[model samples]
Each structure stands twice: as structure tokens, then as C-alpha cells.
Target: MGIISMIIIGLIAGAIARLLVPGKENFGWIGTILLGIVGGYVGGTLGSMVFAPHKFTVQPPVNHAFLGAIVGAVILLVIYKFVRARV
Candidate 1:
């Protein structure tokens, strides 16, 4: 997928992730969107590392991409909360 496609997917994935996780975040919608984009990158990278050899990539089908994004977002959210709590 292209940058634009990734952004769109990230937006949706980010929104879904935000809804899935219950808690007050430090950022707003734009932050969520950016988080999603970063999540997409992180997820894609990790997924590639874990599943690339097995060829279980999340590129072709949209579902995998969405799933990956959610996973990534959740991870980021957790980290964010952890760090925020420390500050």
C-alpha cells in the first residue's frame, strides 16, 4: 500500500484501537491518528520480523493490516500510560 493508503488505514485502525482501549489519553484525535501511523510502522516491522520467514505478512489482505495496527496501537497505548504514570 501507498503512503496515502497507509494513512487512511492508520486513521481507521487508530480510531478502532482508541475505542478498544478504555482510558483517558493525553492526546486528541490527531494524536491518535499519528499514533496509528506509527503503530502501523511498528506493527508492520515486527510482523515482518516475526512472520516474514513464514510468509505470514499483513500486506495483501486488509484484515491483517487492521489487526496489526490494532495490536501496535494497543502496545503503544500501554507504553504511553506507563511512561505518563511515571512522570
Candidate 2:
């Protein structure tokens, strides 16, 4: 999928993840959407590079993409927290 498609997928995945993960305040619509878009891109890039032998397609498997999106969001959130703590 292209960046646009990935962003869409990520947005959906991220929102779902945020809803499901629980425990803290949600990122709101705009932040959640942005996180998802970025998560999709990061997840796709990392997954493809690490799993190069699979001939990773731009159109990633939905499960993998979803997993990637969630992971990316978690990573982003963690980093955000870390940076915020230092500020």
C-alpha cells in the first residue's frame, strides 16, 4: 500500500489500539490520527527491512500491519512520555 493507504490503515489501527489498551487518557482525534499515520509508516518500514526475506510487500498482511501500527503507537507513546519527563 502507498503512504496514504498506510496512513488510513494506521489511523484505524491506532484508534482501536488506544481504545483497547486502556489505563490513560486518550490522545484525542487529531493526535491519535497522526500517531496512527506515523505508526503505520514506521512499522511498515521496520517490518519490511527486518523481514526482507519474506519479500515484504507494500501491501502488508493486515495482521502484520495492524500489529505494526500498535507497536509503533506504543513506541511513540513511550517516547513521548520519556521526552515529556525530561522537559
Candidate 3:
């Protein structure tokens, strides 16, 4: 169940993340997929950490997996940008 959910969220989050970010991204399809999954975990962890006591029914909202993915993607994107700039 968790694995399936992660995949779904990864796809959605990766799409949303790409939209949120400005400019062009050079990652291919596979890279994007990986980014999304990682992003979801990142977003979920951060969300949970910061709002530990806020209990909002679903709390973590499984649907928000995409958000997590986006967070992960964004971080990766930033890192890529920074490294690219240095190179």
C-alpha cells in the first residue's frame, strides 16, 4: 500500500513540482521519476516534523505525496543550479 501510494504521489508531485519551478529543467523522464519519489519523502518528513502536533484529520494527507515529491525535486533542482553555476 505504501509503495503504491508512493508511486502515485511521485507522478503527481513531479508534475506539480516541474510546474512550480521556473525555467527549463534538463532531467530526463527517469530522472524526473526518481526526483518525484524522493521529493515526496522529503515533503512528508518536513511536513510531519514541523506540524507534529497539528493533527488535521488525515494528518499527513496521503494525497499530499505529490507535495513531498515537489519538495524533493525543488531541493535537487536548487542543488543542480548551484553546482552548475560553479562549473
Q: Score each candidate by Cα lDDT.
A: 0.80, 0.73, 0.70
Candidate with the greatest TM-score versus the true structure: 1
Question: Candidate 1 has which clashing residue pairs, if any?
Answer: none
In candidate 1, where is summed lDDT lowest over 10 consecutive residues? 53-62
TM-score of each: 0.78, 0.67, 0.69
State the lDDT of candidate 2 residue by residue for 1-84, as single tens digits.
Answer: 777776677678678757665456457777887888787667778888887656555765467777877777767766776776
lDDT of the structure predicted as candidate 1: 0.80
RMSD of 2: 3.8
| Better model by TM-score: candidate 2 vs candidate 3 | 3
Off by over 4 Å in 2: 1-8, 16-26, 53-62
Which runs of model 3 end up more than 4 angstroms from their true locations? 2-4, 53-62
Q: Write one digit per residue (lDDT tens) for candidate 3, span 4-80.
A: 76676676667677777776777767667777887767777887787654547656635454555687778767777
